[model samples]
Target: MAFLEIDSLHKTFGANTALHHFDMKIERGEFITFLGPSGCGKTTVLRMIAGFEAPTRGTIRLDGRDVTHLRTRQRKVGMVFQAYALFPNMTVAENIGFGLKVAHRPQSEIKQRVDEMLQLIKLPHLGERYPWQLSGGQQQRVALARALAGKPQVLLLDEPLSALDAKIRISLRQDIRALQRELGITSIFVTHDQEEALSISDRIVVMNEGRVEQIGTPLEIYNYPRTRFVASFVGTLNILSGHVIDPSTGRMAVDGQELRTAQTLPVGDAGKKRMLALRPEAIVLEAPAAGRNTLTATVEEVSFLGAIVRIRTRVKDEVISLDIFNDPNRRLPERGQPVALGFSHENLLVLEEGVQG
Candidate 1:
């Protein structure tokens, strides 16, 4: 049996729905992430798991026990908020031991746990420092320490690194992943940052407007997206509208040019419109080789990013962003330069065409 299960979880506020028929089975010690844009119900799922918000319908089972209607304190769960909700008056040690203190543990046990948590967070010397005396990263560390101080059954982090700067966010997110692995804790993280989700999650649940678009490992989510939303939202994809020439053979006509996909294509009319997803890195700016699809394009813009040169080009009405490795010896193409893009038929992805989540 799974360690935690969220079955048909639904939430609504007045006339607007926040989450819809969400279902997931999480094993023990697995790190899952709910990834989506703002107001996509990722945080709402986290809140439901944390027992801070009651679901309008469905059930949440933890370790074989249903805790959907339990109060926050009754459910053995720890939560770290985006904002460091540490008390200003309390010292770092006090904040770390707040949960233990609230549970009415012995003073001696509380002290021992506080000392252990301080060492766990690698801030043993800052025990006496107040929240105002610490930096943003330090304050977040204190918040994380407090959450783990009680040894809860599960840990929930609601955009814990959103408030930090880019450098600090990267560093702290790595630390959080390392800590989670060390403790072997079952955890759920909520974030809109695709890079962050791809880096740290054991499995990613991609949500869209209260519905789940796809759920899979980072590589699975990136390489084989099931829907149009999954393909475009998770990474940079060039959406090309084409007419199906041979649905069974996965052949399509784009800009009066021919291309094929290795994936399954629907059976329909020969001129039916279909959407295709192609990654930027899949195309090489070179002449067409044997058994390759070639697209003629004109360079519209060139962006010189670090370690990468992004060449933006257009083939008819479709715009494609191609990323190439930066080379000091090679001169870049100027705007309005004509170019030919080549890619394999296997790299062309067939996206589901219809209403997106």
Candidate 2:
């Protein structure tokens, strides 16, 4: 059996539904991420799992025991928020040992555990300082140490690094992942940032408008999105509208140009208009090769993003973006220059016609 399971979970506030039949199973020591934009129910799922919010309908099972209606204290789950919720009146050591103290652990044991936590977080010398004396990043580390000090069964982080600067956020996320792996704790992270989710998660659950769009590994979610929303939301995708000419051969027409795809169209989807998703890096600006789809386009704009060059080209009425590695020795095409774009059939994805916001 899975270590943790959320079955048929549903949450509603008044007339507004926050989550709709959300279900998931997490293995012991697995790292799962709930990735989505604001108001997409990702945070709602996290809160429900933490026992902070009661589900209108469902069951939460941990180690084969039902905990759906359990109180927050009974769940033994540790949570770290976006803002470091450190007690202003306490020292770092005191904050880390607060949970142990509340449970009436011996003073010597609490002191030993607090010192261990400070060493684990690499802030042993700062334990004597107060929260107000530390930087934002240091305060967040203290908060994380506090959450893990109790040795809870599960750890939940809700945008914990979103408040830190870019460099610190990157560094702290690496530390958090390493610590999670070392402790072998079942963890769930909630974040709207795609880069962070892709970098840290063992599996990603993409949610949209209170529903799950897709659930898979980072590579599967990025390279083989199952829905239009998943294609557009997970990464940078160029969606082109077209119609399938032959479902048996996977042929389609886009912007007055013919193209082949590796995907077999649905039985009744032939002759129907559909959307094709292609990544910016998939399009190549080079001479057309055999068995490749090629189109003539005019360069509309060029942007140099360190290590990569982004070129926006106008093909008929549609604009397609292409990314090429930056070569200091080679010259790039100027604006208004005509160029030929080529891409393989395998990179072209036939996605669902309707995309949810």
**TM-score of each model, in listed order:** 0.96, 0.97
Candidate 1 lDDT over 130-174, as tens digits, reads 999999999999999999999998999999999999999999999
Model 2 agreement with the true structure over 1-357: per-residue lDDT tens digits: 999999999999999999999989999999999999999999999999999999999999988889999998788889999988999999999999999999899999999999999999999899989999999999999999999999999999999999989999999999999999999999999999999999999999999889888889999989988889889888888888888899888999988788999988887888888888899999998887899988789999999999999999988878899999999998999999999999999999998654332
For all the candidates, what are their Cα RMSDs to the real structure? 1.5, 1.6
Q: What residue pairs are clashing in model 2?
A: none
